[model samples]
Target: MIPIGMIDALPFGNSRRVRNANKFTELKASIAIRGVIQSVLLRPAADRFEIIAGYGRWLACLELGLTEIPALIKPLSDEEALEHQMEENLNREDLNIIDECKAVQQLSAFYNGDRQAIADRLAWTMKKVNERIEILKCCDEVLEAVTNGTITVGHAMILAPFSTKLQQGTLSKILTEKWTVSYLRERASKGQQNLALAKFDTAACNTCPHNSAAQSGLFGLEDQKAACSQPNCFKEKTASWLEIRKAELTEQYGTVLLIQQIDESDRNTVDSLVVGEEQFSVGCQACEKRVVLIDDRLGRALGSTYENQCIDNLCFSKCVSALTSPTPIIENEELLVAALENELGNTTPTISTETAPLKAKKAKTEVSCVVPKKVIETNKAMLRQTSVDLLMPQECFQLAMTYAALKRLTSNYKSINKELSNPNRFEDTFKAALRLNVSDLKAEIQNITLHLASIESDQTINITNMMIDNITFAADAKAVAVAKWIPTKEILSEYTIGSLSALCIKAGVDKAMDSKKEGGFSTASSAGKGKFVDAILAAEFDWSGFAPDEYIALIK
Candidate 1:
């Protein structure tokens, strides 16, 4: 046991095999409760001690604020320390297969790259050591699947003999279709003696030592060479030869192309294709890889567009890669110029200074696009009005509705324009636009009604009623808010009898009734609504006293 200073002298590769980060907390707690039960292993160094196997215990000691840790000191070289650490970590039952393989690799390095020596040192058979080593050579997917228990180590061994592409396909099928080991073995065996490979040199394959059919010393004493096997070699060579031919065809045609299968029903015309009875136009212009044909013999012999069909009738891999990778998006001239000053400062030497005058001239030309004086005045008149533009949008919208309703009540409302002393063109525009706005409002209301019908809830009625009240409130608020001088008499004709009664009552209707005889009340009622409305508007009135329902009723 010796004193420990800082916990930095040792590398953590051998000590880092842990299932969870909670183990650190648990180790720390254990040290706090009972102190380090096992001493941290240390190797002698120039300045301090290098940790061998007890890194967690050291960390726990450091966390407990203990300056010294109980450590077994050993005078050993780097390889000897690493070997000791690997042996210590590998003995732990909690080590996963990945960490186990890594420990084995480290231990093997200690034996001067001799797996047999490592096997002898650990008392593990050479075959078992090699089997675990081969696990590392398998693809990451296979490793993950094996670790997850989706596929067994035996399945990985069988798949290890195939090409990476085939291995990936088999893994995908195993995951998607839940393939059994026997099913995978059968599928793999069938491909080894396929009809495609049978045509090529049978005599050569029968006697060939590389062929799996030969069955002698298939397992080499050294590392296995999966690519040198019969089935894989034949397929790879054939693919390479065809790839060369495909490249030649591309060179002859002088353009990239994409080949797609067309349904037999739609094969009469060269202009289009069909996929399962659904016709799609494949015009030369629509083709993504329509090469520019030089007007030569081959160009004339075949049309301008050539389908990317290979001699073996397979879609090219490069075409799929091209489809997956989109073309770089380019910014337009307008966008470039707009952001040019921010993007390219005066210090930037990329864009030439000589072109500055031309750019400035173009900018001036764009800025000088003439707008007519009439249009400028009209726009100013539309937007600059303080009286109308200052009103809340909701209030203005309601006023528009009121005006539209009034215009419908009065067929010749346009002729009866009693302009205010201080004229408002907005009110005049509202009167002019009344008909159009009414149509839009009706369509909007219809859509709202349809939408409301689809929703069934306890709040539906409340929501609908609230919407109605809001629209009515905005319109009524704007309608009675008189500015400058209003033509109250002209507006009276659009008002209903209920509105007339409300207005008259608001204007001291009881007082008017007292002055006139009670017998004349019947006369006033019988005189028709036109004269009564005129009389009511001519009379001095306070409309503010009326309820909102009564006030808005005039517009309705």
Candidate 2:
């Protein structure tokens, strides 16, 4: 026990307070009631003692106007004192991950980059130590985002697996748009963590911290653990794994097989070597899943469902044979689902009171590794036996595209189309256009748990022609076009308000909120318009076309 006056802070003191410094009011109250619970470490200075730790206690004593505080006198060098201060603060205070990371790094450097020494001194597990240091390895954008309040440690950890450019863009969208952590998490994990669900890699997914399974405690909440939190990284890894497998298979088979971006388009789609190799045409079974095609949104994405693919059982059996187990590097969705159910395990999340059931449960079927191809096949066969008009997801997706395409091609629109301006009219017209009487589209979607996956570049060009040949539109196609366009205003109001605000900021627009009342982006907002400004700009999702005035008119 000693008087507080006996121990001097430092010759320069630590400015008494730093920015974002934690308040000591609670500590002050505690000491005022119970006195100092632990003694601050002190070392002999020139005339008095210097505090090596317990700055909070020193502050508390000062706040309580106490003449003395408990002190443990020790002998330490300046560097040793700093180390003690850092370690003590880290263990005591719930420091942010970035600060904790920096402190860990300083300790490592102070000990000549000795991992074991740092771990031993800090009394931390090597795993924990290594993980903390890993945070410091993130790109500057991610680190800065963490340092500021832009992102949580969990977000940074997930982003650590992606490209630097992607991290920068994702962080920008997150911060500028004020997205919820849940939304960011869901968006980040949108696809099968970049590995197609059809060819999901269970073993890699199970062990990766980027996998929600490996990140159980990362978010400090059970439900908050997102699945495949780094889709970009997952996609890259899956692609590399596929390439390595392809090479090995090529070496074994003594010829080339499936090539081109994962969507199987003709850009690099047709192999000259395969021209003479018609006898060895292995399969285009997973062709759509294995190629990348450019989208109308000017982005590279996967292809769509292939129904004209008329193979049914024959193709299915062939796929099974080619993808049988113990075969060198062949992955299929059902097998991945089997691994998920048996190996990693899938627990349906308990519904949370905080989140809306619509949003929370929208993802229920999505995160599951269960493959629906067999189930859908069974449904199709049953439907074929009954009436074939019961529309499945594949059928519905094609219908939606055909409707959009037909509308685009249709020219004549005048007063008769005015009645179709209502948003509900589009839904009705879309169903009417589908021409399915017995099937309820919404129910079918829910039952099948269908995602369109991708629009497939070929569909965009040929859908109108295909639809014209098969079914006829009820009203003037222009009215249907107007109906499809009607939903545009609803999407603009509901989804794109924040997105527009974000785009405006990226375009260097001034005070985006000034136009928020009407939910419109003004030309005066910035000089950057029409042109995509950011590397990963999302103008399509944000609602482009129709200037501020014209768009407001349309909405009205």
Candidate 3:
């Protein structure tokens, strides 16, 4: 078996489907532990292989670090290869709904040319299929929901009966209100019936009694003529006049009533209120005279008509009261101060006198109580002098291994805590980090870890596992395992390398220890030196060498 590094990726095949399936970390782990048992199907190419059936297996093997993966290279025509590729993907359970719908449509066309039969084959009724098609006709609002995986086919089906405009409006409202599918369905049903009924009622009201009253002219001279000529004309005239009278009374009694054209400006204020030949009239219920208050605008009679009626009596009383009322005046600050001093003169005052020394002591106590606290000094010297030493090779190795193990544990934790975190798997992130093989950048790693901790605390899901997995994959596991034994933040804050090395040996990784011919101290020193050198060499490379010039230039 060749080393896994020698194998190249398969060419001329669908990469998207392969990548999606490989997102299953369990599958990747299985391939990692067990050698690839089955071979992938491929079509023979000039120099490369065209993957047909086992794309997932091929990706898994690559991830597992297998140098030469087992592949069954077949010499098939283009048409045959295409058929095999399609069949393989068709069998996958993770096929998206859009693809499934398109497949049904295509297959239906290929078979009996009847779409309904195709829908039947899929266990979906003709109506259901039609609804799905209608969802496709929906505007961006509904389509965006489908694409974003926010709304399901069932939800879209429920909305199918609505016209595009209505669907868009409803969809917007649903999103804004954060409504569930059930709520949306209920609202749609009720809204449709209510909207239809409202339209009908509004159309009917356009010709109803209240609306037609203004157009019927019963309050005008035509109504007066009708009243004099017809037998029931007086009743009709009274009804119309009463309706108009009630409206005017309602307006007059309403809170914060707007008295039409009552100018409050100094010059026009009283002039605008003056009543002239233009008479202001309102029908009164007390004595229906269609009361015309004339002369001044203050509801006063112009002539001596209906002098004994209740309307005339009430108007005269109101006008006389308003004319005789006193004008109001506002007081200034000097007058207010004089009034306050006069009020204070009627009250008694009390006084307490303290002896000289006691009074001085009381004043001092008050001053002290009112004063603010003094500022405390900070240990800025110690803070400025702080420096973190780079981790030795073994320490780095141990950390990487611990990160990998933690990554594996995080995956298990995520499965149990599905709703608690984001769906991005930590294992994948760890694997990527491991691929980088970082060991010498201990300070950077520590900073990153601290930043990540802050992010993990705020985020729904823990990405710590993915980060650890990536670091472990990039670095040597043996060295990482040794580093894991070192003291954590609390212990490291006080202890130096000499104190920590004993702890490392106790935790294991003493296997790589140097000869102790001179002494244990000498051996430990040698080991530390070797590990540090290894870490430095690993981190010194120019990573730009591996990237394309275009990418490097873009970064620059």
Local distance difference test values of all predictions, in order:
0.46, 0.44, 0.38
TM-score of each: 0.35, 0.30, 0.27
Model 3: per-residue lDDT, tens digit, 208-276?
333332345554624211011221232234335444543433222211111110111101111102211
Best by TM-score: 1
Candidate 1 ranges beyond 4 A from true positions:
1-4, 9-12, 15-19, 22-25, 62-66, 192-556
Models, CA RMSD each? 38.7, 31.5, 39.7
Model 1 quality (TM-score):
0.35
**How much is 227 displaced in model 1, in angstroms?**
12
| Residue lDDT tens for model 2, 1-556 | 7677777775323312222444566677778899998988889887788887888788778767898878888888665677667767676445666666666655543443456787898788988777776565466788878778678877776665444556678888878898777787787677434333413356656676666565555558564343566656755655565565544332222222221111111122322132212211212311221222211110122222122121122223333343332133314444444444544545543333235222111111111011123222332232232222222334554554444334433332211233222313333434444554324444433322332332322223432223332322333432222223322232322212223333244333423333443323343223232221321132223323312222222221
Q: Please report the candidate that would top lDDT against the real structure.
A: 1
lDDT of 1 by residue, 73-104 (tens): 88886557767887787787766776666566
| Location of the lowest summed lDDT over 10 successive residues in candidate 1 | 361-370
